[model samples]
Target chain A: MTKLFIPLDSFAVACGADTIAEEFKRLVADRKLSIEIVRNGSRGMAWLEPMIEVETPDGRIAYGPIEPGEAETLVDAGVLSGAGHEKRIGKVEEHPFFRAQTRHTFKRCGITDPLSLDDYKAHGGLKGLERAIGIGAETVIAEVTDSGLRGRGGAGFPTGIKWKTVAEAKGARKYIVANADEGDSGTFADRMIMEGDPYCLIEGMAIAGVATGATKGYIYLRSEYPVAIDVMREAISRAHQAGVLGASVLGSAHVFDIEVRVGAGAYVCGEETSLLDSLEGKRGQVRFKPPLPAIQGLFGMPTVINNVITLASTPEILSAGAAAYKDMGMGRSRGTIPIQLGGNVRHGGLFEAPFGMTLGEIVNEIGGGTASGRPVRAVQVGGPLGAYFPVSLFDTPFDYEAFAAKDGLIGHAGIVVFDDTVDMMAQAKFAFEFCAIESCGKCTPCRVGAVRGYETVKKIIDGEHPAENLVLVEDLCNTMKFGSLCALGGFTPYPVMSAIRHFPEDFHGEPMRVAAE
Target chain B: MVFQARYDEAEAAEIIGEHRHLEGPLLPILHGIQERFGHVSEEAVRQVAAALNLTRAEVHGVVTFYHDFRKAPAGRHVLKVCRAEACQAAGGDAIAGAIETALGVKFGETTPDGQVTLEAVYCLGLCATAPSAMLDRRIVGRLSEAKIGALVEEARL
Candidate 1:
């Protein structure tokens, strides 16, 4: 009779959504009401998590941050009729946070049952696969090329070119590897898609297989995401049973299937080469490029490795056409980027907007500033390796090339805000420490240089030869930036150097005052 | 105390056999072994190496490389606190200190009664609710001193 939706996404679950769901089930049974609860993926407005939506004749009504104890009170107040309660935040789509987002890739995430193929197809799912299968492999690559989709894994390489390279490369059997190892700290776009809308990723990977003539696909997911791992495994099995996977996909002659491989807790495995090595049951180490993964990859066969978001965006690009997808954003970044706002922000969640929104709008207007109610000191755009942008650079637009021009990276687009109380010196040290911990030790610059960087920053923090060590730190960073094999060592200097550049007062003689006294 | 059924070579071999058909079966087999027993023992490594037709050094290297694999049994429960930048920005240092004091054990150490083992993790992707931690597969976020105290008490049980 009546239907209620609750999120099964990990973030919601962590916030006690499961307990609240159970409470609702018990209350419904006790009252003998004709009500049904559907477990849906999160709407990404994490602040209002454990958010329950009730389906009415008009539309779905939303209420949230529902504590387990409040379920009884809310339901007793005739929540089924979409009655006004203090918790009711009206239709979710009308909310400021949801309204502002462009929501191209994440269109169906917060809505629909993630596992139901009928629901997926009902909400514009398999149109892309059908279109790809109809257009043939060459046309699929051409469409992707026209869409201007680049690697969302932070490299910004053209996805169409990669597929074309794999398609023409001389190989009897090719492979499609989805780099789902989302180890970046403030990033969870990959995790959300995998848990919320797995078929979207599965469909994208299948399209890649059809386009590249690759039959086998593997999703190298991180072990930290146990819930995503479980959801994906079940989703893959369901896809196989429904003919979305396995031989003769959707009754076509294009034989393609997918497998979910878990990564051992190695952050370095996020690198394409390191992920392939880990997939082969070897130590997760980076391999030198000359022959990139597109040419020789995954057991020495040409492999098309695309990030979760990059692959997930394809279903829409194929369904909506390349021009529709291409016309949304500014310049080269011609699509919606799912920017994850976290840390000390008041309204921390995923904001999917087209490129060209200034950092000021994102932090102040959308995020509503810090949760601590203090003046914002710095915002770290990207992950641990990304630079810390001061308030002065808040005018910088959310674009790939723009961030690079600012001597920073839009890596994975995870913007973490910090209040005025943050210590930039400690943050600088952490940049090096994180590198030292996660480095694959492939190159001496990353492995040893990181340790030295950490120690050098520590010396600066202790006010030891502050002038001399600052120069030493700069020289060491230059060495690592030039000599390192991968971004793990190369880009680490972004945070370290940016901290010194933007907030020099923190890095000099302040902590030593107590010792001097 | 940590519940570890004595390591059986036959059981380890059976788990290894289950995954041998897949491409790159070592990591999965090791995961299977660790799940069966609390830790990956030296003898288990030897059996896996022999079964996979690889050197013992190779298997050992893999086990050591990844942070997830354990060489010995842990306490009854494992607690991992987030140490990444996002968490650090959200009073994570205070959370870390409070948990250590509450549990009477440091990051990589187990309590005296073998009740809980505390460890530090980079991130759990719960940055939205910053200052997060995972206790025995259940994630607790937006952590404060009181929440962590309760978590420590739950681990003891």
Candidate 2:
């Protein structure tokens, strides 16, 4: 039997499409037409939704944003026989937006129904888990290590090293924790993962459990992303039903499970230790890490804590083999980055690409420049803590070493673009005050220095004793950077310093408008 | 820190007990207590501390640590204006000024009428709809100073 597959893509309008695909299926059954109807995730070319893609020798033909009323015409027009609307985007793969992405983690995103297991399998979803299940723990760790996949949650720490630490640690009660607290300014990759490909994260966590000997896993989510939390929980529950997460997963010796924990409203909980602190029924505070979470974490047990992106990248690395994952990026920053272009950018969304792409390329070529159409003046990489880059250094590559070489860190791959209209002083102050508000207050330098830094920056902007406050502010940042307990306090200097370095004129204000130092 | 005037031990216990068995239930418990009693009571924190076998300092550390978990109750409505770079680029300062002028209260302070509490939300992920303000968890995007008052008023806090 020569079979045909027709995918009806519409979520909000699914009730209508349901009737149509059903009729199409009924019509097929009645006419003895060999056809398969599948409900898939939106192609994101939302204008052309309720789209039906029918397979044939030529390629899949597209007909979309179709009303139930138009379903019959589409079918009559032989949409099932590789026919489509004249206005169709044509081949899904040929579409520029879909083609632009180097989608490793999000390969199947927007292509399959987020809720359907059968559709997910049809798209090569659990093959990674099935492949990973057969591999030994050491081999799994080696492949990930070779992949050089780093934590995409701001800090580019080697994910394989983190997993290896827990895998090597002696513990019967180990835990794998995924931080879905994407509270950063211009980041949604984590939220997108939870919404679009939640099963990927579940599979990654389960794979981490199999690798690290962790039986229990938990995803700590910030309350801001209520949708992700709901979707992730549902995915996790379904995993349990499918025997993908529960004891002896996929009928193997590996036993794993996950539960979702909601953060009431804490951004600091996105930090791993703070997340564990919140997980342990305490306030979200950073712990002084000598023992590290891998050795002793989350109930004082050995834990493999990784950001959502870090874990999500793992299943693909293990499944595709390290060479395939590693072959993409430059130098030590292997594997593709799912950079989230947020803020004033025109085409802001998740763009997965190789590491060597320049800031200018990402902002201009992929991002289509600032949404306001003004000259792109500055960009803050990572999150609030990342430094602002001036137009002078737009050639900087998207990598840990590259960003660090330019005195910045790819903290979570969150790139916030700004047009010429932004004031540097205010954004600089937010970094300091963010540190102040979210500080654990365990260290005097961060607790005291952050407030001091905020005030000094305010003084600089006010232009009262400008030179003195500028000196004092730099001094405060230096103290906090060097003396603080963790990155929260340490990295606040990146933005403040860069704003001063790049946009010194903004801090100086009009020279005539300035007061005495 | 003054003890909350409306702190009820039984109610707080009921709230804490509800999510006690949940995984990492601290945040939900804290949220529940804050929701019921107008603020997180010392008694409740102590109860959490005791229930979880954690030190009061640890519970306090967690409470004082995150910007979201309040040691005290929030105002009837939360008006969170985006203060991140994306919003700023799209004119967040003007919106903030208008809100400050309208509410007669600065960021983090609740208006005396208990109508609204103005806070800074770093990013609402509605950057495409920049210059956004979240009115008590409901995201309102593509905002301006002129539009903020009506949006704030619509919340009826």
lDDT of 1 at A43: 90
The 10 consecutive residues of candidate 2 chain A with the worst lDDT sum are: A6-15
lDDT of 2 by residue, A202-264 (tens): 988988988889999999887766556767888888889988889888899998989888776
TM-scores vs. true structure, each candidate: 0.98, 0.84
- To one decimal place, how large is model 2's interface RMSD in Å? 4.9
- Model 2 lDDT, residue B5, Cα: 47
Worst lDDT window (10 residues) for model 1 chain A? A508-517
Model 2 DockQ reads 0.32
Compose the digit string of candidate 1's lDDT tens values, residues A52-114. Answer: 899998799999888768888898898888999988988999999999999889999979888
Query: lDDT score, residue A374, model 2?
Result: 96
Candidate 1, B-chain TM: 0.96
Report chain A TM-scores, every model: 0.98, 0.85
Instruction: Return the top candidate by DockQ.
Output: 1
